[model samples]
Target: MADQDFDVVVVGSGAGALLGAIRAQEQGLKTLLVEKADLFGGTSALSGGGIWIPANYDQARAGVRDDLRTAFGYMLRCVRGMASEDRVLAYVETANTMAEYLRSIGVPYRCMPKYADYYPHIEGSMPGGRTMDPVDFNAARLGVDALETMRACPPGSKLFGRISINAFQAHSMLSREFKSRFQLIGMMLGYFLDYPWRRKTQRDRRLTGGQALIAGLLTAARKAGVQMWRNAPLRELVQDASGRVTGVVVEKDGRQLQIRARKGVLLGAGGFERNQAMREQYLTQPSRAEWTATPVGGNTGDAHRAGQAVGAQLHLMDWSWGAPTMDVPKEPAFRAIFVERSLPGCMVVNSRGERFLNESGPYPEFQQAMLADHARGNGSVPAWIVFDAGFRAQNPMGPLMPGSAVPDSKLRKSWLGKVYWKGETLDELAAQIGVDAAGLKDSARRMTEYARTGKDLDFDRGGNVFDRYYGDPRLKNPNLGPIEKGPFYAMQLWPGEIGTKGGLLTDRDARVLDTHGQVIPGLYCVGNNSASVMGPAYAGAGSTLGPAMTFAFRAVSDMLGRPLPLQHADWLEQPERAAQRPAERMAQAA
Candidate 1:
C-alpha cells in the first residue's frame, strides 16, 4: 500500500536518471522521475558534457576502427584491479549500444576525432575518436517554463558566462584558429539577434556541453510521458519481509510519501562530495566540501545513504573524479582548472616551488599526484599555477579570459587579489604566493629552457599525444613554454572533484549488490550513486557520463525483465580464463 504508484521510480534528475525514466516510460512502465533540488539537472548540466564510448557508430562512420578487445585491454590497464571484469566488459560491449539507442530517440552526438584517450601510452589506447559530445540543443524547444527551471551550466563551461559552445568549438577557440574566431563572432551575433527569446530571457537559447546533453534527454523524456517531480528527495528504501525492496519513501513538500514501484527503484542521485563529514572520513585529507565543483547542496549523498541503509555494499570510497580547482569571488563552488594547466607557458608548483608530476596529464592523474606529493610532506595541498604575462595574453585561466580578450584593467576589482596574484619578477611572484623564491626562479628558468628545446626535461610534460590535446598547437611543443615575461601570475589550486566515485556497488546489470555480493532485488543503481565501472582511473573524456548512462540503460533493461545480452558470455563463465592477461583477452577478441 502506498500514496502513489508507478512502474518505475527514478531518483535524481541527472542525465543517467532521465535516460532510465525515459526508457522505462517509453516501454510502458509509467516512470516517475524525482530530484532533491528544485532544479532538474545535477552536476551533469554544469559539466563539459563529454562522453567516452569506445567503438561508437559516430567513430565508425568517421572511418575510425575500434573493437572490444582493444577497448577492454585499455580498461584492464586503467582500472588496475579496482573494477570487476564483468562490469568493465559490460561497459565496452554496451556503451555504443547505449549511444545508438539515444540517437534513435533523437539525441544525436558528434564524435570528437581529436580528443584522444586519456592514457595514450597504455596498451590498446586509441589516438582519438573514443570521446564524443552532444549536438548543441536549442533549449527553446522545451519552452520557457522548463528552460527556466532547468539547471544552467556554470560560467566555466560558457563563453563569458553567457554564450554556449560545444566541445569542438571550445577546442577550436582555445587553439585560436582563424576559422574558429570567425565562428565565435557569428555565434555572438546569433545569440544577440535571437529576437523575442532574448527579450523574454537572458538564458541563452542555445545549450552546449552538459546542458545540451541534458536538454536532449529531457526533451525525449517529456515526449515519452515520464512524470517529473522537483524537490522530492528520497528518504528511505522500503524493503519487505523477504529483504526485497518494494518502494521508496520520499520527502515532498513537508511530508513523506511512499511511492511503490512495480518494477524497481533506480538510484542515480550522484555522490557524497558535498558531505564534508564523508569527505574527511573517506577521501584523502586536506579535502573540503567547498572545493568540489558539483552543484552546491545538489549531491549530499541522499542516494548513497538510502542504498547503504538497505544492505548495499560500497566500493572506491577513497576516490573521486578529481580535478585541480580554484576559488572565485561570489561563486558557490570552486572552478575546475581544465585545459588551463595544460596550456603552454604555465606550470603548477607546490609551496616549496617545485614540480612533482607532469602538469599536462589527465586531470585525475594531476590531482592524484598533487595529493601524493602532499602526503610526502611536500606541502603541495594548496599548490599554485604560476604563469607569465605572455601566457596570460594568449590563454584563459579559470574565470579570467585571455588578456588580449579581457585585460586585467577591465577585471572586477574583487577578483584581483583573491583570484589572480601578480608580481613583476619570479622572486616577487613567489613571495606573493608564499612560495620558495629561489626554487620558483630555478623552476622558471628550467621551464624556459625546456620551452626553447621543445622538451620538458624534468617531467616530460607534452610527451604524450593526450597531453597535447588541449595545448597550444601553434607552439613546437604545445605544452612546453617559458615563464619569462614580467608581471607573472599565480592562482591557488585545490584538489577539487566533479563528484565522489564511491557509492553502492552494483552488478553487471546495474542491480545493487549487497555486502555478500548477492543482488538486492528491485534495487538498481547508476551514475555517481554506484561505484564507477571504470574504477579509479578515467578512461577518457565523458568517462563519467558515458558509463553512467550505459549502466542506466542496462538497469532499465533488467527492470523490464529483458536483460541486455552480455558480450563473451562463454569467456566470462570460466573464472580462470577471465583472469588471463590482456594480451590473451585481445587474442580471444581477435
Candidate 2:
C-alpha cells in the first residue's frame, strides 16, 4: 500500500470527529477526517444536539447561574460511584471551557428551556444549565456542494414534509392554546417554502438541532482548512515497531491505503449498534438490528474492534444510550420514541401483562427496567407498549401519525407475529398481544382507578416534571390517564439504544488505555468509541454529546500541549449567584 501522510488522522465524522480535526488543524497539524458512509455526519446529525456543559457562559449571560461544585455533586450522585471521580471532575472542570472554545471557533450555543435533569432530586442535578443546545445554523452558509453533503434528519423526525423541530417546540405543540398552534404553523410555513425549492437545488437552507450541530462544525472545519473524505472506512490501525499507533489503513475506492499520522490517530467513530453479532455478544438483552435507531451499517464498531484487537482496555461493555424505538419501514433509522411513552393513557408491560415501569421515565431508565425484567427469568424480550383508542385519537403514537388509522398490513400476522397489534376488547387484545387475559384485565382496572384518584399506586407515573414534560398539559393528571377505551393498541419493544456507550477505555487526557492500564502512546478516542465519563447514568440532556465533545477538546488540548481554559467567569464562584437555582432556569428559558 502507498503511504498517505498527515500529522493527525481522525476516524469518524460525528461531533467528536469534526471537532478534533478542526482543533488539530488549528494547531497547524495536517489533520483529516475519514468517514465510512457516503454522508459526512453520523448519529450526531440525527440527535437532539444538546451538549450538557456544566457551567456554560450561555447560562451566565442569561442570568441563569450554575457552578462547578454543584454540577460535580449532581454527577457524583447520579453515577452512584460507577464512574471515575477524577474523570468526572475533569469533565465538570473542563465542560464550560469547551463551550467557550467552540464559540471561539464559530459554533454558538443557547441554553435549552425547562430541560430538567433526568433525576432532578439528585444532589448536583439542576432543572437547567446542565445542558446547552447549538444555535440554529443556516445551511446556506456551507455553500451548495457542502450543503448537499450534509446528512438530513431521519425519517420519523420531520413533520408535514421537509420540516424539523426542537424539543421545546415538540413539547409546546402538545398544548391547546392558539399560541402554540400558531407557532407550529409559522414554523411549518418556513419548511413549506423550502419543500419545493429543495426539489430543484442542492441547498436545503434551513438546519436545526443535530443538522445544525454537524453543519456548523463542518463549516468551522472547512474554514480552518481541515480535509475530510467520505466512503473511506478505516480498515485497521497502523502502528510502529515500538507499538505506538502511527496511522491507519483505510479501504477507499476498493483499495487499502496506509495513511501515516506523525502525532496520533483520534478514534471518534461511533458504536456497534447495528452489528447483530456484537449486539448478542456484548449487550445483555439486545434488540434486533432491524428495530434499532442507529443508521444502517453506520456504527458497526470498526474503530472499537481495531482498538480491541490492539489490546485497548474495554470497560462498560454492557451499557448504551438506550431508547425504546419501533420499526417504520419508510423511516431509514428507528421510529422515534421521544413523546409517545409520556403521553397520557400509555403503559408498558412484560409478557405476563403486568406493568413493569414508569413509562414516562427517561429511555435509559426504561431500558434498565426492561433488562431487569428479562433477568427475572421470565421471557420479557418483547415487552408490549400499549395504549387505548382515545389515546391514539388524542396523540401520535410512534410513527403512526396522529388521526391516522393503523395500517392494515401491520395488523396481519407473520412469522414475527404482528409488530403492531390492535383489538376491540381487553381479552381479544390480550390474545392478540400474547398475554394473559386476566392479568391484562387486572392491570387495566387498576390504572383506571388510579387515573380518577390522580395517583399511580404501582409506579407513580406522573410524579415528576420530566414525566410531565411530554404530557398533554390540559389533562388533570397529565401522564396518568386510563387505557379504558375500546380499540386498544400495542407495539412490541425490545432492548434498543440511541447508540452503544461501551468502547475503548481512555484516561483523563482521552488517551486510549491498554488492557494492562498503560497508555497507547499515539492513540486517543472520543465520542462513543471511548468509555463514557458518565458510566451507567445519563445525568442530563446531551450527557453523551457533552462528554464526547469535551474529551475531544481535551484530547486536542493534550495533543497540542495547551492549558485548558478556566471553566467560568470569576464572579460565578459566589454561592448565591452560582447556577440558575431551582425553578429559575425554567423562567429564564421562558
Q: Write the per-residue lDDT of candidate 1 for residues 1-590, one digit (tens) a residue.
A: 89999989999999899989999998989999999898998999998878899988898677788888789889978987666787888899999899999899878887888889999888999988999889888887887888877898776667888888888888887777789979899889989889888887888998888888888888898888899999989999999999889899999989999999889999999999999988988999889999889999889988898888999988888989999999988778899888888888999899889988899899998889999999998888889899999999988999989999899999998786788899999888888888999888888999999999998988899999899888878788999989999999999999999998988988888999887778899999998999887877899999999999999999989988899877676545445643443335435544
Candidate 2, residues 1-590, lDDT tens digits: the string is 43788999999999988988998999899997999999988999989898988778888676677878888878866765445556677788988888888889877888865677888667767776667877777777786688678777875676654576766677687655557778778876776667655765633466778888899999999999998999999999988889999889998899988998888899999988888888888887545676678778699989999998788987677888887777655567766576688887878878788998998888898877888898995556778888888877777776666644444454334513445677889899899878888888888888888888888988889888778777767777788788899888888777778898988978767888887778898899998988787878889889988888889888888777673644433323233322222124224333
How does model 1 score by TM-score?
0.96
Q: Model-by-model lDDT, in order?
A: 0.88, 0.79
Mark the regions of model 2 whose C-alpha exceeds 4 Å error after superposition: 61-63, 175-178, 199-204, 404-419, 563-590
**Residue 167 C-alpha lDDT in model 2:** 61
Best prediction by lDDT: 1
The TM-score, computed over Cα atoms with residue i paired to residue i, of candidate 2 is 0.91
Which pairs of residues have clashing backbones in candidate 1? Answer: 50-542
Displacement of residue 114 (Cα, Å) in model 2 is 0.8
TM-score of each: 0.96, 0.91
Report how far residue 252 has shifted in candidate 2, in Å.
1.7
Query: Residue 449 lDDT in model 1?
Result: 95
